[model samples]
Target: MLSPASIVPVILAGGSGTRLWPVSRDSLPKQFQSLHGTNTLYQDTLKRVSDRSLFSAPIVLTHEDFRFFARRQAQDIGIDTTVVLEPTRRDSGPALLAAAMVAQRLAGEGCLVLALAADHVVLDEALFVDACRAAGRAASDGHIVTFGITPTEPSTAYGYIRPGSAAGTSEARKVDAFVEKPDTVTAARYLAEGYLWNSGNFLFPASLLIEEAERFEPAIVAAVREAVELSVEDLGFIRLDAKAFADSPAKSIDYAVMEKTTRAAVVEGKFRWSDIGSWDALRALEPGDAAGNVTHGPVTLLDSTNNYIHTDGPLVATVGVDNLAVVATEDAVLVMPASRSQDVKALVAKLKSDRHNAASEHLKAHRPWGTYQTICRGERFHVKKIVVEPGGRLSLQKHYHRAEHWIVVKGTAEVTLDGRVFEVRENESTYLPLGGVHRLANPGKIPLELIEVQTGSYLGEDDIVRLEDVYNRS
Candidate 1:
């Protein structure tokens, strides 16, 4: 068992958010992007629990594809975390259960697990911490505690929690009922009836949560337990057994435990919170100008009223626009009425049906080593700008259908070509013929920047043939 700690933060960071498209894609989700402030939402979440007196080292649960992003982002903020990889998307039921099992195994039976979504924004962190303490007290009393945000508006986007009588002397109250997202009329009535918005964050003792979960969903507990038992350490990450994790049913925590439990409790949270589920929600969180326009990245609003225009691609000038959201990226632009922000998901679904690349990926793709952005691509040629972080290394691989030329723009590049290793300095160039084994790495203290040009009969990512990989890819 591990050392004594009050609460173990279980951060879920594996969501592929589609609602905030163009900026938030499958390649890099909103939690990893600097959306709200200078730091990403995930970093903000990490900072919220960095107080060692109140909490222990966090355990981050994410998908296998986001393993590097989760680990690197935490490292960037100087926060050490235990990264756990989920084999598949089985919803929060199995995810939280797996985390509780892990925490129990490490920190013993009385360890408390706090489930925090990595993508959410909590403005009043002081009040948020206070509420967590209140919830922790209730959880220690054998109650599953969920933080309920006091409703500021009649919002239909979030679920509702009806709190009943008080639980002991703590600020937490017994959960009377858990309600689904209601219609506008029902939402207004709920606001009048003193219901709280379900924030989806939970705190409970590890063993108690597993017991309740087994009482409700025995198979989920069994599968997650076996998965945790069979889990292996992969480069400092815990990779759950794929077959065992996949055997668990896909269900949410509400359906598996909280909604059916008698020991459920809620602590009223007065702090400002936002899930940033849509563009309209994001616009609502920001401050607008005199014309009621929120603009970012070289935007000029002309007679615009209540418009949110953000662009990182080019200068965006709006003329006589109202209640509209214009978002632009390097590869795609989304323009729609701010009121219809929820419909962007349907538009993205249509784009996915049409097999559009922008629906899922961005121009810049992140890898374990660094990042690469496509400058331009044509029928037989592709140009890319790559940035490799200090000490980062790409896989030892080759292409069957393409030849490549790399020109170093920054730092020193340690290049390996056809079993010959050499150093290419700034402004130096190197070439690799078709079917020639090659690898690129940064050996300097600074980031390595390079421009790569590829010429081939068929230019596709599937042409890569990995002879060896440090990340252990197939």
Candidate 2:
């Protein structure tokens, strides 16, 4: 068995979950949202490898837009994670390479790195950990190991891995070949032929992975090495060099290394796993009534069977609906058959083509400080509900074409208008004319909540000119 302290968990948390749109958008993806239970999928993934005896603090690789959210969620669960900010989305190949280099520098060459996707749901935690331990043994013997889930069904959504003869004395076997997602007929044949679903989770020795990457894709290794070398620590995140990272090819780890490596091995994982790629996948995990209906939030079902209904706000009532998935948010509602869950991406594409903001972002936008939800908007006025956490502060900035009115509803607000600084208590209001330098902050122990009304010719976010900021924004 590999030493417990020798394992470093590396989580890949960069993905725009377009297939699960409406609920999952570019601003906040499904991984960061609390979809399954109290904890989000990312939090659940972190908790799986949180055993200090078996794993070290995890390294989270995410996009620049999501760095704060990832850090905040990790902190909420008492996990001390090292966050790495990717300058651009170059897929998992470069991300993993950069993470491997970082892990090697931190824990030496012999250390094993466990790579996992942040969006997957593993129902069986004990079985998952057991498979990790088994993969570690194979990785310790200089083999790059991948956990393969036993095929429970002929699923076309996931790729396949064919296991060969046993690798030494471990339960891991040599990977014969990797197959892409096949048609229903082909998938059935593969399932009957004993093929396993590629779980996309891997365990590899730091030095060995780097060595293989250098052999197969030297350009990727070189670019990522430069990016890592020039990386700088900002706030609490490590920001990779933008130019070098952007120069690297955008490819998945499967294409760049796993499929080409001679040391590839597969470990059979009996744990129940789901990537939660669509609403149908999520509904399968949720508890349903005797009539086969799963409902969340304030939802009422009447004569509904085999339906999934969810609502974030307002009541959603279904009458005589079957085999349907109805998801309602504050600003948008989606109704479709459960079988067409994968078609949500096409719908999102159509929305984006029409320049609909709901396709990419929700009504609520999250910032480093807290969150702001758009209440109403018209031709010349926009209303928003802003929440600021304790010790949170916005940038010292000014808007050119817009004036703002703020009314405090919860805690105290420390306002700085031009050169003047004052405190606005509960139920009090403040105003700033156009081109007036202003900043908002919360100095109290409790969260600060307020309503902001903007009236102007142009109220776009790009109108802001930041003179100073604590959570640096451009």
Candidate 3:
């Protein structure tokens, strides 16, 4: 049961975070990675709203590729949440509209919805919650409230919000205007003028948001309404209608509603917050050593000052490097000046144009069941290490161009070959011929690990024909 006074938290988790290159990718973005601490940014956001007395079960909006990752992260923190799957990336406007519709349906028109991004880091949790509460009061009065961070630096990276007169007896103020990312000089002037950094978080009444969005962008509201209306449940996920959602204009909420709505209000947020927009921003958040060097994962620095070095594989040793960032992964390495961290997006764009897989995907790919990492690949064959969690099952499918040989390395695997199910223990092996329908499942209490060798004319993922799927992958 949910309390009537509880605010509905709508967490947007859909961005690809391209600037944080080698570590963050479309396959697993920065929100899903543990960049700062043990918990991912998404999990940290979930923890902020875990107080059931103040917040209801959150409504998470994510894309199809990250649906399981979002759900699994919620389950990791024991949070009961509603995961809404966006059929396509339609930016924050339609996504929020759809979430507002869901909130209205669940909690009624008067319910307050706290819209937050899943990839932000707030150092002061209590101050953040207090700010949300203050914003909630303004939102309850039918004002669309956006949290504005007190600018600590003249950062040209974030948009600015000019605060106007007070809304009421509360600390909320009318939003005078919203400004785009400015030049360094303009940012300094804005900071001196007491402008707030638009934190990209909002609190609004469900009915108010719907009304404002409908007034400003009726087409978006119409398309998203249809998308939510025709949404279907797939493996416990509410999947918005693809065609309807794709029709909605791809615009941020700031451009679509916040900038145009007359009832926009700003609440001053005193908490320490960062979007972690790039590696430089990330380095700013992390505490450095005596030499002003932030190092992680087997990194040794000699005569390196004001540098950030991180590696997931191999030792990253830097000598006589100043103001540099060297990040390494199993498949890719990025070495650049710390000041040029913003240019990583341009590098990613070039990589994408060049058809490089490392631009958008990591070596390890996460699936609904578990994860698989490509060890090596050749023209006609590829080797992969697949790990299946306990009670996890893959789809019953067959490939048209590939045959697989699975060597069990750990735990037990329940293999089904053309409806004949059998258990293959550790160190055991099984072979599936091309065009043979098969399924792999972990029936044991521990994770099942296997080395899969594929020999085929084609090794692409699209060659699969799913006969039946528990996760509805087709």
Candidate 4:
């Protein structure tokens, strides 16, 4: 059996949350955003497993598009991590197998793997760590263990696990069966019958999990094994082979192995947990005022009860409104009854069907260097507010159909125009002629802020021709 300190955390961070629209999109999902406290959900997950005595360095499994986001956020919290990039979306089945393969490569077959979802919130960190240690022990004894949260309510948002009998002398129990999300009546019955909410976190030895997966789905094992073998190191991240990984079927671990295995076990978690899947879930987690209202940012309320109001743009004020959720951002706003928050996913799907830009793209676009927000846009013209961190640099490229003008508002900008590099101080401005090679960099210690104005026939982001890029983007 492996020791408690031999556990390796394999965090899953590639979910594209659509229910929390306007704030969570394909570009920046809910895991990377600060929804609960000061830190993002991803950062919170990292901190939960940061104890060096119990857990080793984490391996974050995410998509290729989110590699930089994962890296930067981990750096922000002073946590070192190994990032694995999945070339495509292939559900938790491939993700877990890939994690096992990577963990085995790093710590050998004897180490235990603690799989965690990056978008969950646990109010009790001490209880969570204790449960992880217990689950690690159970997993070390040749069993695939999953943590089950004690159900505080009849939640239709989560699945349920039926624990059969005790596993040996420990508190862990053998799983009877895994059930899907049930209706209100079924959920209440499950809650009253002493079933636990499936938290989607699992623990097992690397070798044993591979064996179980191979028995249930041999094609997935073959594909993920080859993908890991052919994986390439790019920008300090492991990029799995695209073709080999994509050959595997998209299925969750519960479907591929947990339901089919005989050694499935579960440990009870008494801590408060929530996936934060909808606005109602988030509101229930936060402390409400006297009127049962949860709010964030610049929000004002009068005669509103049981409402959730949030805004990061203009001041949001409400009156005589009850059981509603009003969320507003710089570019979009979502207004719905709190009871119908689950229907936001359908609304997002409708927006995507209509080809709306708000369906996926946010006003603020993040890049490897920094972020740029669209300030204004009109026919034949576009304006942007750009922020570059210290030592950050843009690609050396030229626009095909647009000429640009930049006004530095803060710090200094190292501008490269037509192979001539010079520094522009605060309040200084520079111009880039059409078809001229240009680049932007922040050579100062402080962050550089600038306003960029573009005039051209096409202002689409795809109009750039990259001459060189430090980020290795094509």
Q: Give the number of colliding residue pairs in candidate 4.
A: 0
- Model 1: lDDT equals 0.92
Q: Which ten residues in a row have the lowest lDDT in candidate 2?
A: 1-10
lDDT of each: 0.92, 0.93, 0.92, 0.93
Better candidate by lDDT, 2 or 3: 2
Give candidate 3's TM-score.
0.98
Clash pairs, candidate 2, are none
Clashes of each: 0, 0, 0, 0
lDDT of 3 at 328: 95
Per-residue lDDT of candidate 2, residues 42-90 (tens digit): 9999999999888999999999999998999999999999999999999
Best-performing candidate as measured by TM-score? 2
Candidate 1, position 297, lDDT: 93
Per-residue CA lDDT of model 4 for 314-418, tens digit only, reads 899998999889999988999998899999999999999999988999999999989999999999999999999999999999998999999999999999998
Query: Candidate 3 residues 1-474, lDDT tens each?
Result: 224556999999998999999899999999999998899999999999988889989999999999999999999889988999999998899999999998888887778899999999999999998998889888777689999999999998999999999997677999999999999999999999999999999999888888998899999999999999999988888999999999999888988999999999999999999999999888888899999999889998788898899899788988898999999999999999888998999999999999999999898999999999999999999999999999999999999999999999999999999889998998999999999999999989999999999999999988889888888876
Pairs of colliding residues, candidate 3: none
Q: After superposition, how far is residue 119 of candidate 4 from its true place, in Å?
A: 0.7
For candidate 3, what is the total of clashing residue pairs? 0
Candidate 1: pairs in clash: none
